[model samples]
Target: MLPYSEEHAQFRDTVRRFVEREVAPHHARWESEGAVDRDLWRKAGDAGLLLTNIPADYGGGDGDFLTSVIMIEEFMRGVFSGPGFRLHSDIVAPYILHLGTEEQKRSILPRMASGETIGAVAMTEPGAGSDLASIRTIARREGNELVVSGQKTFITNGGLADLIVVACKTDPAAGAKGVSLVLVEADRPGFSRGKNLEKIGMKAQDTSELFFDEVRVPASNLLGTEGKGFAHLMTELPRERLLVGIVAVSVMEAALCWTLDHVHERKAFGRPLIEFQNTRFVLAEVKTKVTVARTFLDDCVLRLMRGELDVATAAMAKWWLSDLECEVVDACLQMFGGYGYMREYPIARAYEDARVHRIYAGSNEIMKELVARSL
Candidate 1:
C-alpha cells in the first residue's frame, strides 16, 4: 500500500504545481545571485506553502507532518533547492511549537507561517560541528535579559533569517546540562551576519556566518527550559535526519529519471545509448538501488508519522539513502559524459548537490556510529 492518503496525494499535486510555477523558473537566477529573492518567500506564504504543518491558529495550514514530507519531496524532485523551506518549516517551527511558551508561539509562528520572518537555527559553531556538548557560545543571564556572545558558522538561511534560534551554554560549568536554546532577532544590536558563504552546491540557499557579540534578548526568548538544549536537540534530531533521507531518495529518483531520458535519446555507434549492454546493465543497478531506497524511505516516513521512528532507525535511513544518492548521481553524470560536468546541465548541479548529503544532518560517518551504538 502507498504511504500517502488521498488527501496527501491531493496536496502533492498542489505542491507540484507551485514548484513548477514559482520555484523551477527562477532557480537559475537565484543560484547565480547566491540567494533567493526575498519576494519569493512572501509568494510561497501566499500560496500556503511555507509552513503547511503548523496549527491553523498560528496562520499555518494545520496539515500533518506528511504534508511537509510531500512538499520536500516535490521541491527536491523539481530541483528547487534554493529556498531552504524544509529548514524553516520542518525544523525551526517544530522547536517553537513544541518548546516555546504560548507567548513565543503566538509572537513568532504567525510571522514564520506568513514568511514575514525567515527562521534559521544556529547550532553548529566554529568549534562544534556535530558535537552539541562542545558548543562554546555562551548566554549569560544579566538582570532581565540574556547576553549572547559567540560565532556560528555554516548557518543555513543565515544571510536572510530575521529570527535565529541560537544554541549556547547558559551554565558552562554544567557540560551538556548547561546548554540552552535562545531566540535572537537579526535586527538586534550586536548581532551581525557575515558574507553569504560561497558553497560547492545549494548556492542559493543563503548559508552564512553569524556573530553575536553580547546580543541581548529578553529572558523570555529562551526556548524550552534552561540547561536542556541538548535534550531538546536529541528529541528533534530523528525527524531532521529523516528529512535528509527524504531529500536523498527524492534526488536519487530525479537523477535516475534524468539519466534514463538522456540514455534513451543520445546515440553512440549509430544506436541509442540505452540499447547498449553496458548502459542497460548500469541503469538496471541504479534502478534497483533507487527502488530499494525509496521503499525504505517510505516506510521511515510512515513510521515518523506514527511517532515510532527511533534515532537508530532514522540514522540508518539517513546514511544508507544519502550514500545511495551520491553513487546514483555519479553514475548518472557518467552517462551524460562531458555535458554532465557543465553547470548548464541539471545533472551537473545534481552532482554538486549530492556530495553534501553525506556531510550534513549528522555526517554519514556519525550516522554509522549512532547505528553501531544500537548494536
Candidate 2:
C-alpha cells in the first residue's frame, strides 16, 4: 500500500508462494528441531531472497530497502519464525557492507549472498544486554594479530555463523569510546559455540552462546576505526529498531486476521463468537489499533527509504508497535478460549513469539530512554 511498484507486487507474490511451498510445510519440524534446516539458507539465496538490498556486484539482488520490507512482511504474514534470514540479511550484512574494507566485502559478501557462509554479530554478553558500553569482551593486539577474549550470548545464527562481527574493548578505561568492532572468523582455534539455546518462542531460530577464548585474527579485520564501535552501532541502531517495528506490525496484522476468521466460525452461547457484543467490541478495538500501527509503520518505512528516519522516531516505532503487538496477540488469543492455549494453533505460537520483541534490540524501556533524551 505504501506506493509499491508493479515489481514490488510481483515480488510479494513470489515471496508468498515461496513461503507456502518451502517454509510453512517444514516450520513445525524446524520448531521441533530447535533450528531450521541448513539447506533453507541456500534455497533462499537461490531464490534471490537474501541480501535484496545489496548491490549486484556483490552477488545480491540489487533491490532497495522496500524489497527487504516486502520479504519481512510476507514471512510474518504466515507467522513463520523458523528462518533467521532477516537477521542474516538486513541486520548483520549491513554492518559488513557499510564498515568493512573492500577486500573484506569482496571476499565475504558474495559468499554470504550465495548462502555458502552464514554471518552473525556478537554484542550481548552475559552481564551486558542494553548496556553495550559495559561489555567486557577484550581484543588485545599482539603484533599483527588481535587476540579476542570474551563471550557473547543470545547470538542469532551463532551455531551456523561462519563470520562474526565481534564487539571488543580496545581501551577499557575509555568506557563507550573504548569499544571496537572486530571481524572474527568462526573457525579460529579458540572460537566455539555453545549448544543452541532453548526459548519460549521463535524455537525454530538458532540462538546460542559464542565463546572467544583468545581467538585470533589479523589487525586488518578491524571494522571501521579503532575505538569507534559504539558510534558505529549508534549509526545503525535506528535501522535495527525500525526492523523490530516492521516485524511488530506484521505480526499484529496476522494475528488480527487469524482472530477474525476464528470468531466468525467459532460458536459461543447459541451463536457464532462474532455475534456477541463483547467479541465485536474487542475485534473493533483490535482493528483500530492495528490500522493506526500500520499507518505509522508505513510512514517510518518511507522515512527509512528517504534516509530521514532519526533515532528517536525509530525508537518510538520499535517500542510502541512491539507493545501493541503483544497486546493485540494476547487479546486475540483470549478470543479463542481453550483452543488458543494449544500449540497446534498459529495464534498460540504468535503469543509465544510476541514477547521477545519487547526485550531485544534494546529493551522497550531503553527505547523510551533514547526517545526521552531527544525530547
Best by lDDT: 2
Candidate 1 to truth, TM:
0.98
lDDT of 2 by residue, 1-375 (tens): 588899988989988988999999999999999998899899888888998898898888888898888998899987798888888899888898899898988888888988888888899999998999999999999999999999999999988888999999999899999999999998899999999999999999999999999998999999989999999999988999999999989888888898999999998677999999999999999999999999999999999989999999999999999999999999999999999999889899989998999999999999999999998
Which runs in model 2 stand beyond 4 Å of their true positions? none
Worst 10 residues of 2 by lDDT: 78-87
lDDT of each: 0.91, 0.92
* Top TM-score prediction, candidate number: 2
Which residues of candidate 1, in runs, are more than 4 Å off?
none
Which pairs clash (backbone N, Cα, C closer than 3 Å) in model 1?
none
- In angstroms, the error of model 2 at 6 is 1.0
Given candidate 2, what's the lDDT at residue 165? 90
